[model samples]
Target chain A: MKEIAEKVVAGDVRTVARLIRDIDDGMPHVRDALKRLFPHTGRAYVIGITGAPGVGKSTLVDQMISHLRKNGKTVGVLAVDPTSPFSGGAILGDRVRMQRHSMDEGVFIRSLATRGHFGGLTQSTRSAIDVLDAMGKDYILVETVGVGQDEVDVVRSAHTTLIIVIPGMGDDIQAIKAGILEVGDIFVINKADRDGTDKTMSDLRLMIDMDQKKYKDGKWKPPILKTQAVFDQGVKELMDTIEEHRLYNFKTHGDLPFRKRKDRVGQELAEMVKARLIEEVIGGLVESGAFDMVVEEIVSGKLDPYTACERIVIPVLGKRP
Target chain B: MVQKRRLRVMVAKPGLDGHDRGARIIARAFRDAGFEVVYTGLHQTPEQIVDAAIQEDVDLIGLSSLAGAHRYLFPRVVEILRERKAEDIMVCGGGIVPEADIPVMKKAGLKEIFTPGTTLDSIVAWVNANVKPR
Candidate 1:
């Protein structure tokens, strides 16, 4: 594990890829390598791009890779696609769009399948990001599985989240919906050569105005940009805007955006705790037959779920909350 | 939680082949067979395919070429993988190759070749029987 972690930190592509695969497979002993890699993370800036399907997210990401590489920054991309629920498999076609960067040693593109995970990302996305970060990438671009409202977990993982929409997609209404609108650090109207480009841009500007009314002084406003990703138009300006946002974040939140980093680490800790508790406590009960007894009692209407929970907890905690 | 090891395959359309109907079909078939399939779209160079296969840590690569470049493109992919020390990634070829070139391709390190009319099931079954996640 130490050797693997060392190789990953030294930017060995094969070792990093294998570690990420192990994370995706949920293989045991991966946590040891991740633990060793933890302190080496937080060096890369994580940017997330998300939008509905067919909104040109992958095309935009491809352009972004080119722009970033031109600026002499090493990049790591994690492009996710949804898994097939019926077959437990996925056609990770995002790489199809970014194949131009396949031979570029400065860029590493990885495709991830959601593997039954919701929230527009796979369960291993965070760990994969860390692996990339520890590999010494200057920038990490996480392109979520084309997302809708409420599949906004990308906000928690990315320092800058770009919400992409094409013109004439009724995405203005989607932008007004609860979950996705509030999470954008930048709004991009890709495929801007299409007809409804001005309408979508104006609509996004109006929404941004309304959303900005509640912000305090020095808060970052999500800028709306227009781009024809297929034609590579406006992509350089988008890269400039992203760099501007990165600098703004540094000025507002110190060198590393301490608050956001703390929040992300806190969330990671909470998830780990929840998983560990379920595995240790609940798994123990299920193994000892107590959980089965409670389930049978509840199914037969002899016990209520709230009381059953209390009964189960009292034995474990020796008191009721 | 112990998750089952899953196979990762790259279905690449190598060379200047503009026809990708067979590649797309086989990619979907692999997905339906419960393997993660990474589809490299039209006109991939051997270097691009080998780089992607290494970066993805794919267990196998299915090279498709309908433009009659399999004799060169297919073996070139295997040769590059061998040079990169990633020859553990199994290489297979499909589409428009003549029967006479099969021996040369095999000699160059292609593990299997699926010509026209090969059933999708048989290909998937062959991958299942031959490749294991490393």
Candidate 2:
């Protein structure tokens, strides 16, 4: 596992994936491995893509990846999806659009399931980003499952979030405004060749102007760019806008809001501790047959789940004699 | 006696399908049934799915496509798996899979198809029976 971690830090995709599995499995060495590789991360520029569904988010991301590649930037993509209820699997089929980059050694693509995490981004997305960063990718693009709120939370983790909107969905503007309109660093009006492009762009511009008035100081103003992702129109400009935003943050704030290296490392450590403690407690419970006992109680209706949790936590909460 | 490696399964949803109440429930059940499950969140593509399976070196790829693209999408996933030399990993699918579509899915090399309301025991049994651990 240590050897694998070293290889992962050196950017071996296979090793990185294996380490992620070990981490996901709550393997004992997972945290240790990550701790060792933590220093190797934070070099990659993290970009997030989000939007409402049917807005061609995936198409636009595909275009963005190609654009990044042309500029000699190694790219990593984390596309999150929801898990299926009956199959216990995911229907994550969006990678179909970017099949051309499947074999590119410079491009690493991973799909994660949101699994009812409501935040749209998978917990695993961060770990996967760790892998990409260690591999020394110049840029990492994280695409959230475009379900409004989750998308917003997921993109909040990115250094630059580009919210893709399509023309003709007058309702989409209202919906996004009600949800994540303010969260975007860059708003992309994709499918620009589609009907109502002009109207949609104007409406978005008006909304942006209206919203900007709320902030007294001229803080972050999200740039609204028109793009036809399928035709690759305005992709270069969009990329430039993303860079411009990155530069703006560096110049004005002296730091990027999206690249909080300390916060991420702190989060990783906290999650590790939480996972470890849970494992220890649960391992003891299962070994003591406490788990089976609880299951039996639930089945027999002797204890409701809320009370059953109390039964489990009470013992752990009490100090050891 | 040689012990079998614990079967690791990756369950994922691809595309714009938002209905995941079923996927989450199954992930919990599979964990109880003693399989190490890696769930890739919704809206994943076939390439990403296969890439994950290959990277995880999982024994099975359990896809749940409830949005009705199973006919067009499932087969393409199998093709990618073959290309990645992961054809040996048993492919299974679930999630609103109509009884009628089972034949086509099976023909596409999907070993098992679990529909809605299927029990976790059945899924465990199928994995224990069909999957050969490498």
Name the runs in model 2 displaced over 4 angstroms: A25-28, A116-122, A148-151, A213-218, A253-315, A319-321, B1-128, B132-134
Query: For candidate 1, lDDT tens digit of each residue in A1-321?
Result: 999999999999999999999988767688899999988988899998988788899999999999889889999999888789899888999998999999999999999887753231333788899899999999999987445422366445788889888888774446445567787888899989899989888888887788666666878888899998999999988988998998888887787643246776687667666555555567678767888999999999999999998887777777776
TM-score of chain B of 2: 0.91
Q: Score the docking of each candidate (DockQ).
A: 0.58, 0.09
Top-scoring candidate (DockQ): 1
User: Which lDDT tens digits does candidate 2 get at residues A32-136?
Assistant: 777677778778888989876667777888898998999999998887765554444454445656656756778877655554332213334676677778778
- In order, the interface RMSDs are 2.6, 8.4
TM-score of chain A of 1: 0.86
